[model samples]
Target chain A: MTNIITICRKELKSYFSSPIAYLLMAMFAFLFGFFFWNAVGYFVSMSFQAQMSGRTIPMDVNEMIIRPLLMNVSVIGLFLIPLIAMRLFAEEKRSGTIELLLTSPIHDMEIIVGKWLAATILYACLLGISALNILFLFAYGQPDWKPLLIGYLGLILQAGGLLAIGAFISTTTKNQIIAGAVTFGACLMLWVLEWVAGYETATWATVLSYMSVVRHFEPFSKGVIDTRDLVYFASVIFLGLFLTARSLESLRWRS
Target chain B: MIKVEGLTKRYDRTVAVNNISFEVEKGQIVGFLGPNGAGKTTTMRILTCFLPPSEGTASVAGFDVLQSPMDVKRHIGYLPENPPVYPEMEVEEYLTFVGRLKGIPKADLALRVREASEKCAVAEVSKKLISKLSKGYRQRVGLAQAIIHNPDVLILDEPTAGLDPKQIHETRDLIRSLAGAHTIILSTHILPEVEQTCDHVVIISKGRMVAKDSVQNLTSRLRGQEAVAVEVTGGDNAAIQQRLEQVAGVSRVVARDTRDGRHSYEVESLPGCNVRGDVARAVVESGWNLHELRAVALSLEDVFLELTGAGQAAEGEKQ
Candidate 1:
């Protein structure tokens, strides 16, 4: 456990010390901020029109503004997660430091987990920036903090699932550009799987849609914590990390 | 101690290390000498647990590399051909991370990093970013990380590869100082380095062990068929050569034209014969002013070329 933390600490330090981390953070914050502003503006226009028409429809701030914003954060994560995870293993291999890690006494699983944890933390920091944008909604309007917390929870779970897959893909190559492009392709495919449910309701189509990470995140985005969704995200995270460990083991043989 | 038996590493169609075996006693510095692509790096990688041998076994400090790699890793410090360093990290931070990876206790981590930096002479640049440092400083930083935990064995591959001559001398000295406390296996193709630093040398050619012996013994073993060079002046060249060949145990004599009017002859004697005294006496009795006469012992360079050249010739014929 200490070995894992030691690796995690060093990995995190490297991320922040490079220009990549800050560049990622700024891009995520700017994009998420744009989505937040649009959601708030749409919500205000709807409330003003409803009031002028003398309608008594009650609009919940959490439902009207925060939910769509959380979903937007998830979409933005599809682009951002690849950038964060691409360097985890690819940089190590390119720089020849993989030799140091492989020949160290630490287990392969520890190294994988440490690197994944560091990438996840950076993703969380990105999410935290968007969360600050949501804080303004709480100060003025009467928004329920509980559902906002659940929406952010959904964003994190979704990010965790995608980042793990990106981490696994990063281990397959030494070129960070290739790693990033392939991971982006994979995350896009996962996001587009839900379109299969719209076209056909066949058993195969349903299975494909069920595998889409977006489906599992729906309940949490609506302020409902379902154990089934938790299990799905947990399974995805486990499968991704398991594959990463196997990749690292194969690297020992092929090196 | 280190032991390898019939170790082989094959990458697809090419065999990098083929059926090589050797041993290193405790507290001995063994030089793994071979040309580029001759499997020196492959052998070191196997012992360091970076890769497993495709066949046979290797053990370091009583732990089999394939069976108990973590144990073997715990006992060995390895520096690959290129120094593995994080460009963004300061030297002290890099050393600290490697120390922790080597499982040094938290309390002793700072002290160990300091000691390692001082040993490798990178203490003054401890705060500088690694990418900003010069190549020699970066190489020393790599060495500092390897020795941060002070393992029982050190496996250094081309540790002095890209350094200047003074840095190479200092690195060799540092490696020599580490002897008697650590069993080190340093690999290089430079002949004089092995002669100057290593007590024992294991020469490999085409992934096969060609020779393994103490440095002195390897040279002396090839000294039996050595040549003697004689320089004489103020005599007819043909008469001088004729008289030199008449010495006891002299088998063949070849004379070369000299620019300064001195007659130079390379005399080959029968195996195991010491004909320097006889050649000197014969030249003196002939009234030729003998300027220089000495039996030329085979240098390590000659022995290395002869052994590897034999392997190349065999390979050529097979192909």
Candidate 2:
């Protein structure tokens, strides 16, 4: 456990010491802020038009602003997660430091988990930026915080799944550009798999849609904590990290 | 102590390290000498648990590398050819991180880092970023990381590569100083380095163990096939060559023209034969003034070339 923490600490320090962390945070915050402003602006204009027309339609701020904003944050993560995870193993391989890590007393699983944890934490910090923007809705308006928390939970789980996949992709190459491009391609495929369900009703299409991460995240976006969605995200994370461990093991044979 | 028995490593179809075996006793600085692409790095990687052997077994500090690699790793420190280092980290921070990775207790991490830096002569660059330091300093920092935990065995792959002569000397001296307390196995193609620092040498050629013995023993083993060099005045080149070849135990002779009407002949003798006395008496009987006659001993360079060159020739013939 201490060995894992030591690896985690070094990985985290390396992430922050380079410009990758700051660049990722800046890009994520900027994009999420744009979506947040647009979502809140549309909500305010709709509420004003309702009040001016003498209609008392209930406008739940959680549905109007928070849910859409959380969904938008998830979309932004598709691009940001790849950037965060691309350098995890690629940089180590490029710099010849993988030899040191592999030859050390630490287990391969520990190194994989340590790096994945660091990338997940950085992704969480990106999600926190959008959460800060949503906090303003609760400060002045009468928005229930439960659904908003649930929405962010979904976003975290979803990001964890994607970052794990990105970590696995990072181990396949020594070039960060190739790692990033391949990770983006894989994430995009997972996100768009649900479109196949609309065109076909076959069993294969149903399985494809079930694998779509966006489809599983819908319930959480609407303030529901379904066990199936949680299981889906957990399984993806587990599978991604497991494949990463296998990839690292293959490196010993190929190195 | 380290022991390897019939270890082999193959990458895809090419055999990187063939079935070879050697051992290093406690407190011995053994030199792994080989030419390029001779599997020096591959063997070291297997011993360090960076790569598993395709055949046979290797045990480090009494732990099998394949069965209990963690136990083997705990007792060994390895420095690869490229000096595995992170360019973005400061020297002190990098050493501290490696110390932690090597399972050094947190309480003694700082002191261990400092001691390692001092020993490797990298304390002056402790605060500097590794990318900002010179190549020599970076190598010293690599050495520092390897010895930070002070393991029982140290494996260094071409540690003195890409350094100036002065830095090479200093690195060899540093390795020499660690000889008594630490069992060090350093690989290099430089002959003088092995002659200066290592107590024993294990020379590999074409991924096979060609020679393993002390430097003196290896050279002395080839002493039987030694040649004699003689310079004489007032003798025809052809006549001198013929007369020298007639000496007992002398197999062949070649004559060369020297300055001031002198002739130099190199006399090749049979195995275990001392023909220097015979050549001198032959010169005196011929009434030629013998200027010089001495037995020529084989140097380490000659032995290395003879071993690796033979391997290369055999490989060339196969192709």
Report the number of clashing residue pairs per model. 0, 0
Q: Would you estimate the TM-scores of all the predictions?
A: 0.90, 0.90
Model 1 lDDT at residue B287: 88
Best by lDDT: 1
Give the C-alpha miss distance for residue B180 in model 1, angstroms: 1.0
Residue pairs with backbone atoms closer than 3 Å in model 2 (clashes): none
Docking class of predicted structure 2: medium
In candidate 1, position A244 carries an lDDT of 95
Estimate candidate 2's alpha-carbon lDDT, on a 0 to 1 scale. 0.90
| Per-residue lDDT of candidate 1, residues B1-319 (tens digit) | 9999999999988899999989999999999999898999999999999988999999999999988999999999999888999999999999999999999999999999999999899999999999999888988998898889999999999999999999999999999988898999999999999999999999998898899999999878777886899999989888888898889999999785675889898899888899899999998888888898887766898889888995467546755
lDDT values, one for every candidate: 0.90, 0.90
Worst 10 residues of 2 chain B by lDDT: B310-319
Q: How many angstroms is the interface RMSD of candidate 1?
A: 0.7
